[model samples]
Target: MRIMMLKGFLVAALLLGTSLSHAKPLVLSSLKPLTLIAQEIAGTAADVDTLLPESASHHDYPLKVSDYSRLQKADLFVWIGPELESFLQKPVANLPATKILTAYDLPGLFWPDEASVSDDHHHAKDPHLWLDARNAVTVARAITEKLIKLDAPNTDLYRKNLQVFASKMHELDNRLLAQMKPASGVGFAVYHEGFAHFVSHYGLRQLDYITFTPEQKPGAKHMQQLRERLSKDGSCLFLEPYNNLQATRDLAQELHLRIGTLDALGTQSTKTYSQLLEQMATDFLTCLTNVRH
Candidate 1:
């Protein structure tokens, strides 16, 4: 009886040890895209949360008192740096260097405005780097690295998740490469110059944009200039969320172009980064083929 009780106590102790594993680390991301990346690495090993809503523009997002508290409670914070979220510069500066990760800090990230894309295809430095799967993989590795350091108990899980994320990203890249090949050299315009990373990554031709900033409406003369230039070569005009849908419809009708909306902020249903990019490619192909989604 004593020997049986000893074995039972040992088993119970082991079970208790397994049950009382490391606490789940909280990774707070500035955007949904980053949050998705973090989620891939964190999985069930950590809790992932997004700091910004999909509806708000990162350029001028108003931070609330609650936002500060969230930032404080997080074990790690990830963002795209001042280039994208200028509003975060001051607040994130308060965090320790070890706790905060940004895109500018990562190497091998493809910035479209740089030598990554053609001059004709590229416009300016695009802050939306997560549009590229390769860049997203890079970010996933960084997040895993930090997670492993912060939550050492789940290092294996984090590392394995990173591998899976990278593999999926490669699969996504290959699929997108083939899918976009059909639409390559096809001229499409956007509401703003934000899709350069996705456009250049997939080799689609972006002819022109309606505005530099989404809120900055071009004057009549400027509109006329775009109209004259694009009326000849532009085949499709893509609008994004928050764009004036009626105006885009009018312009598309005037230009005799197909219409589609490319969402930089992934939809309510978008759970993964791969899903977001795949949806973008599908939307692009649909627009090119004149099959609106």
Candidate 2:
């Protein structure tokens, strides 16, 4: 009788342990870069995942059934909001306001020049706020504060992580600024205008963008105008991994322009926010400064 009773208690204990292990708060970010930021703050206290795959386009993502299910179960949902991921607005609307975080809503976001805003896209704000490290610090603090409230037991850990993140970002900010200093006057073009935050942060010069969104093809007249403009003064054309590479390549070749690749999503970097920023800086320097004239 005693042996049988001990066996039952052990099985119950095992089951309880499994249940507890699965109870970690799940944080779902709309994009990989935001996922990295959430993971850095959440650490082992919560489970963090990105809703969109690395290959998916953030500008025009179609929601799947599984995405809805995931959002329904999420303890927190982080996204760039409707300006970037309009498809998520309806699904996220169903979630409690406390459970949803919009990156663009964070304070100290960089807005593009009024004159530069595209009428075609009709976007009031630049959704790529994460590219700026200062903005990223704001995002990390917001995530940490929310996670601390959700997981009180892990408050100390979350605060500690936030401090570490802030310190590292401060150091990285100076380092990246120095690294980008030489490339300040270098003229570069992009497939999309998503790099405004990055360029404005480091004072780099961007010639122009082929399109506001990658999916939109430049009309023949626009392409001819771009070719003419680029032929006279363009230094290099930077393309994103998800952009229409063939079109970019054709445009680059037509103008005899140097080509460089920038991955704003941090898809190619290790699963860390700092590494993503470093990788972007490296990509910019390597392509913009290293390419022979």
Candidate 3:
């Protein structure tokens, strides 16, 4: 009787251990783009979700009451850091250092030309670093490393996912380069400066930006200057989906220029990170190449 009772307890303990070992880690990312990247690396090893909604802006997102609980419960929290989501600073301060992964610290990031001399209080650093494919590769690797540290049992799977992601990105880079060939010298203007990294990477021309940030409307003097510039050589004007459409439409109509839409947030179709990049490249090509010359 004693031997049988001990055997039953041992079996129960073994079963509990097995279940715990196979449990998936929870990863919380700050935005949709990062969530997509994390999902690529996590595969089936972890559950990943984004804190920000599709319609929200990363620059000034308000943290809801439930967000604090989500952040606290997350095994790993991934974000771009204070340069982009300053609202998260105080809330994430209590989280352990090991629990947070800041993508800004990742190598090969592209900063704006004026970021070096500009004060942080005055000029905001362009937080759209994911626009550059090279930066995305670095970020994906960093995420994989963090996931491995958090969930050792899934290290092999995470590493394998990273390899697949890198391979896919390489193919995307080549495809986008070939597709954007016609847009190389085509002059265009944007409502904001978020596309600098992407435009520079593809060797495309951005004649000028009407506003440095999306939240702020361009003053009359700035609008006039942009109008003058576009009147001379601009083939198209790209407006962000989140920004005020009326202003962009009015400006485009006034300048007699073709209008195109750019969604830097990856809100349109986000089934996968690869899909997001493909859609963005398609939008760029469709707008720039189809412009009325």
Which one wins on TM-score?
2
> Candidate 2: misplaced stretches above 4 Å?
1-22, 112-123, 291-293
lDDT of 1 at 239: 89
Q: Which consecutive 10 residues in model 3 have the weakest lDDT in total?
A: 113-122
Candidate RMSDs in Å, in order, are: 5.9, 3.3, 4.0
With candidate 2 superimposed using the best TM-score fit, by how many Å does residue 248's alpha carbon deviate from the native?
A: 2.7
Estimated TM-score per prediction?
A: 0.87, 0.89, 0.87
What is the lDDT for 148 in model 1? 89
**Poorest lDDT segment (10 consecutive residues) of candidate 2:** 114-123
Q: Write the per-residue lDDT of candidate 3 for residues 105-214, one digit (tens) a residue.
A: 87777655553221222455567888877678889999898988888978999999999889888989898888888888877887777776677778777788877777
Superposed Cα RMSD, model 3 = 4.0
After superposition, the stretches of candidate 3 with alpha carbons farther than 4 Å from their true spots are 1-22, 110-125, 291-293
* lDDT (C-alpha) at residue 229 in model 2: 66
Q: Least accurate stretch of 10 residues (summed lDDT) in model 1?
A: 113-122
> 185-236, model 1: which lDDT tens digit per residue?
6777788767778988887877777776576775677677668766877788
Query: Which clashing pairs does model 3 show?
Result: none
Candidate closest to the true structure, highest lDDT: 1
Q: Rate the local accuracy (lDDT) of all candidates.
A: 0.84, 0.83, 0.82
